[model samples]
Target: MIPTPAFVVDEPLLTLFAGRFEAALERHWPNSILSYSFKTNALPWLISHLRNRGVWAEVVSDHEYELALALGYPPERIVYNGPVKGRERLRAALAAGSMVNLDAKREVEWAAELGREQPDAGLAVGLRVNWDLEARVPGESATGAAGSRFGFNVENGELDAAIARLRTGGVRLAGLHMHRNSRSQSVDVYRASASLAAELIVERGLELDWVDIGGGFFGSLDDSPTFDDYVGAIRECLVGAVDPARTRLIVEPGGSLTAVPIEFHASVVDVKWVGDNRIVVTDTSRTDLDPLFRRRRPFAVDLTTASSATVPTQIVSGFTCMEDDRLLTLEDERELRVGDRLVFRNVGAYTMSYQSTFIELPPAVYVRDAAGAYTRVRERASVSDYLRGNSWLSPES
Candidate 1:
């Protein structure tokens, strides 16, 4: 039997959801491309499976870029993004003809030199565009008040300066990428972004072969907009302004597609009464659920196998020394008992990248098939595993 606190990944469910989202967008906009965000969860198996199913890698680091290349994805299929891009990796990505989106100001200068070096080719590049959407859209700002420290500032003429440098240095500004991190899952936000992009192109009299409004579009959430809805919102703004026939559309999705397929199961280790309220401690730590534990979560208690369900008001926490390790406080009065498994949904996206080696590391991760067969994909951590890495580890006891 697989150990407690192990993760179960449903590969088929992941593919199905991702495929539906991508297919709908592609149907609406034929030139649309969906690139899976590698920073979300870069599990080799997950990346390889998605790659086989026509998803390109949207990587933020050299490590992730290298991971995609090692996974047998062609360099051209990988879209390199992020602000912390080193010169070597950026040069490599440019040389290999990967779709490279410049993030910081220094990156623009690097592209200039590279462009001059490859004069015959006239290097094609993209700049991650960011404007003060808060001032323009008011309450609908996607990047929020503490504005995104990413991309060129359009209002301040940094964008114009960057464009001039590229054009003068023999680099062709073939694409404009605008990715905003929005807290709201509204279609109006995306529409505003699209509209802003169209307006910018018109104002500057610039020509672009592609427009990537980057990811953070609401995924398959309840009452949230669908893939078609998102595309339609963009089309509404872009239809008359930009020539869709000449420009390709790209989206990089992370939490939306991957959140549905994996479930974290943590066995209840101890149950106790703190005054009148009940507290249940699980064998697992909440660190594995990074970025998800920020709000009212989407996890459930598996009551089928549990012998008793005596708890009414329960506070669920993990086996970590960190004081704020509580994951959920069930006010709904559900039945919970010792050894009962707390199954958490919407956990597939960031778990692997956030897996912790806290007081105690977790067990092996298991993958369940459509036929209900379980396979061990990742091995459980052992003491030797942790001790092996310490330089002080020696046989002298």
Candidate 2:
């Protein structure tokens, strides 16, 4: 029997992507490290695979920190980051010997306190800088930019002040970290950021260890540039700037390492004419399957059916109350029927992470192993799963 509306991860494809990234890191940074951002895909199995292959963990929260630990990542190999970190979590990370990328001035003080509390902890602190670089693609804008809620503006006095404050507080400055806007198939953008980072380090006279050019690398999407070409561009730009022998380059890649290896498939349930448009309803919704559809991002779509017949122009939508829960619109008439499979390619990244169970919780997720067998990873959530621990329960305790 075919799987219902589910997410399927291609293990071989993911392994291949990881190998390419490892090769890139070795070629450019040599002794540098490539940490897989855990916030992207926190699946324990996936993290274990990365750890086994020498990829470190980049965590943004306490749960992720715990997950990394559970996955056997030593504190030294894990990089803890995020805008808001609780005191207890900070203490845990500090004690574990993880590198904490301080976002705000408050964290600087917190780190100092932690240092004082644990004199011999040897805490290495890095500051997140805000580099105001526009999206390389014309008319494209990344989620993080100058006005973004993340990082400090190094161009302004903010970075300088933070560094000085850390120095005053007796916090050892390790290196500089900048997460620019995501670059789409533009290696020049990556190179520019790398070069600018090196210049900033030199100008500040800061003893830098690891330069974290944070993740935003595009995956193997139809519109994205080839991975090899993008890697070449980044290498040229980075190598031309800093001496690889002196500093270690750390890349926190999330999507590029995950997206191409996953597939989302849903079955078309109904096809009907709504006003002048033909609406095809599927078993999936935007909240659970294709949240990126709300942003008008394109994905490769294919139809699986016995008949090769094509229908005229049609619009694909989900069975939800929201009129905005539309997935795709075909300009040509595409004949679809109940039980027809709709396959969405390249959904390994933000899709599942941002998914919600607005109207209905998402279906189960499966993994296709190297031997070409499918096994369930996450079972679909039942009603009881939602009701569990909910405060508003019936009088029947």
lDDT of 1 by residue, 149-258 (tens): 88898888888889999988899998888888776757877787888889888988868877888888666645558877888788778877778877878888888888
Residue pair clashes in candidate 1: none
* Model 2 RMSD vs true structure: 3.0
The C-alpha RMSD in Å for every predicted model, in order, reads 2.7, 3.0
Model 2 ranges with Cα > 4 A deviation: 135-146, 183-185, 221-243, 331-334, 391-397
> What's the TM-score of each model vs. the native?
0.92, 0.89
Candidate 2, residues 120-228, lDDT tens digits: the string is 7676688897766664333224554335567787657888888877766667888778766553536666776777777787787667777787888876634456555
**Candidate models: Cα lDDT each:** 0.80, 0.76
In candidate 2, the residue pairs with backbone N, CA or C atoms under 3 Å apart (3 or more residues apart, or in different chains) clash, namely: 130-152, 311-333, 311-334, 311-335, 312-333, 313-332, 313-333
lDDT at 112, model 1 = 90
